[model samples]
Target: MGTEHRTDEHRTDEHRPDVDRALKADCASCFGLCCVALPFAASADFAINKDAGKPCRNLRTDFRCGIHTGLRDSGFPGCTVYDCFGAGQHVSQTTFGGTDWRRAPDTAQQMFAVFPVVRQLHELLWYLTEALKLRPARSLHSEVRGLLERTERLTGLAPDELEKLDVAAHRRDVNALLLRTSELVRAEARRGGKDRRNRRGADLIGARLRGADLRGADLRGAYLIAADLGGADLRLADLIGADLRDTNLSGADLTGCIFLTQPQLNAAKGDSATRLPPELIRPAHWS
Candidate 1:
């Protein structure tokens, strides 16, 4: 595989902090941690069952995917949609001091164990950074920035410490902050006379929400797993921390869907008919 190139033109403006770089996946700077550390079952997304701590069959010695550009055609569509939020590179270059797991086989287990924890922390940082940018959440911006700093610090923990850390507890604390931010932002729609749909952390499994107008709705931490959201209008909706697994988004217009991460979209079920923001690439399994 060839080296990947990322131009700074796609980066945030000068007014924003440098955290955006750390929140974007940089595969070239990574050690293919996601390929080796994460397990995947043979499903619609993945063609094969890969055990945790075991390197993927297509991972090269240089820590690059053998079928990088052709992952979807090669039956590894799940790989193409994954984003570590720069945790892979941080684990490779900083956490482990540039030591390849192949060269230091003894450190493999610990490194693999630490990767997911760090990945979770990095994910929080990604959302917090996004929240800080929302003008409506300006009152919470200082706190969001503080949480972002703390989350970034958590990623830099020693491997043993990282493995021992209770990441779920950390996520709980951050989710609360995100929920507050979502409420503040979505309040605008309520003031505009739109329905005040506060479905935060609700069990919406298998709910019928077709053609529902959810513009600027606070959907943070909502359990939308396998819900039928076909043709739903989710513009300007805050989707941070929402569980989108198997959610039907066919014909859904998410043009201004705020804080909707790529991983969330990847976990959901959508089709060619689904509309998405320009920043989000359509999922391969949607075909």
Candidate 2:
């Protein structure tokens, strides 16, 4: 993956303080390594267009994006929606000691490799911490605490150690604990006993489902790309790993859809062609 290093200036300045503070606390010291490490397509999502390893044209000497203010208007709307959940800075400054891939090209690759590993750990931390906050998930508290400690330790690994880390094994262990936590929480949430279609891997591409009742539906790994799901009721829906590419969700209610992240959402397509919830943003890919 070829990506150009960018400064923090490309990121949204008007971030929600609660989120910004948490993300910053976890990752403010590092530079924008992900932008330079990951590869992106020349879709509407990016402005000037770049290769995977190439630094963005707007990147400045200090590693900030020159077009930060105009990122949306300039055609890089996708960048506006991306949040590493605090992975970049943590790896750049803390794990790598404020060093950069430029000064040490070899280390840049290592930094890039360590980021996703840490981000996944952090994402789990976010969920586990949230689970602990729920009264019903109390039974899983001890397990969650243990997972947090392990996850935290992984996040703090040095670049060399992090690059050599076995992230998959850790994820497997974390998944087991998360599964137990999920079951506990799901059992507590009251739901209507409706005989809904449990379509775990249905191919519903481009199918019209406007204003459809889909409460408590199981759509795991389903290919629903380019399907019209406007005004669809998706309360308590399980959408894990579902291929939602080009799915139209205009006026769709996803208030309780679990495990949906900005990256997943961005990878899927939506537009003025669709009306997303206020909380979500329009990815450049959709344009």
Candidate 3:
């Protein structure tokens, strides 16, 4: 679904406010960490490459992108696609007690380092939370919810603790769970519960798949770099960890696509004719 349809992570009919905040990006309450804590290269997406921890040239003292309204026209189209998953605001308000980098320059280095770590944890939360929402994956709902709670707890760790956290190890663990969940949901996408095509970890870079009926295909971790998916029927497809970089999604229908993150969408090419899952902002680079 688009931008993760928000729902309560209820264990016993209680609304978990903390879990709700873990999924969406609250940019206004953030320190513009994506524009500063992260780096960019001087490509079509950016005017120049910026080093990590260095504030972007277009960043203001107020911690907002100065060229936000005109990012695409201003030669920094990449910025328009970055989503921090609420890690920025949580790092600023909760982790560091609302002390920004400018006001407390001494903490900048450590803050920048921890931003990415928490961001990964939050991204996992987004996936795990969505996994719980799938009716076809009902068998794995308990398992997914458990992982979601643990990932949420990791988001609240102290700065020093978070700095030392092994994020890749945790991501591997979550990936295992999501893989099973994908299989469960995608199985039902086929008529009479037939198995979907399992192209997990296949190298399909630049392969032509235009107008292909790929509904419910298991494309987990598929290397689809630069693959032409124009006009493909991708409804209910499982795209968990699929490398969609440089892939053409122009005029392709992605309605009901599963585990399709914004980062994946940002990496791919698409035009206005592309039918996306609701709430996913179309990339401006796509004409």
lDDT of 2: 0.64
Which digits, one per residue and each the tens of the lDDT, describe model 1 over residues 1-287?
01112232212322245887777788888888999999999987788999999999999988888988898787877776678988998898889999988889888998899888888888888778777766677878778877877888888888889989999999999988987887777776667776666787888988999999998887878999899999899877888878998899988877656889998898888877788765577876674
Q: Model 3: per-residue lDDT, tens digit, 158-201?
A: 99999999999999899899888777666666766664667878
Greater lDDT among 2 and 3 belongs to: 3
Q: Tell me the deviation in Å of residue 137 in model 1.
A: 1.0
User: By TM-score, is 1 or 3 better?
Assistant: 3
- Candidate 3 least-lDDT 10 residues: 6-15
TM-score between model 3 and native: 0.86
Which predicted model would earn the best TM-score?
3
The residue ranges of model 2 lying beyond 4 angstroms of the native Cα positions read: 1-21, 24-29, 43-53, 72-77, 103-106, 133-136, 184-191, 243-245, 265-287
lDDT of each: 0.81, 0.64, 0.81
Which portions of model 1 show Cα errors greater than 4 Å?
A: 1-15, 201-208, 221-231, 243-251, 267-287
Residue 86 of model 3: what lDDT? 82
Clashes of 3: 0
TM-score of each model, in listed order: 0.83, 0.72, 0.86
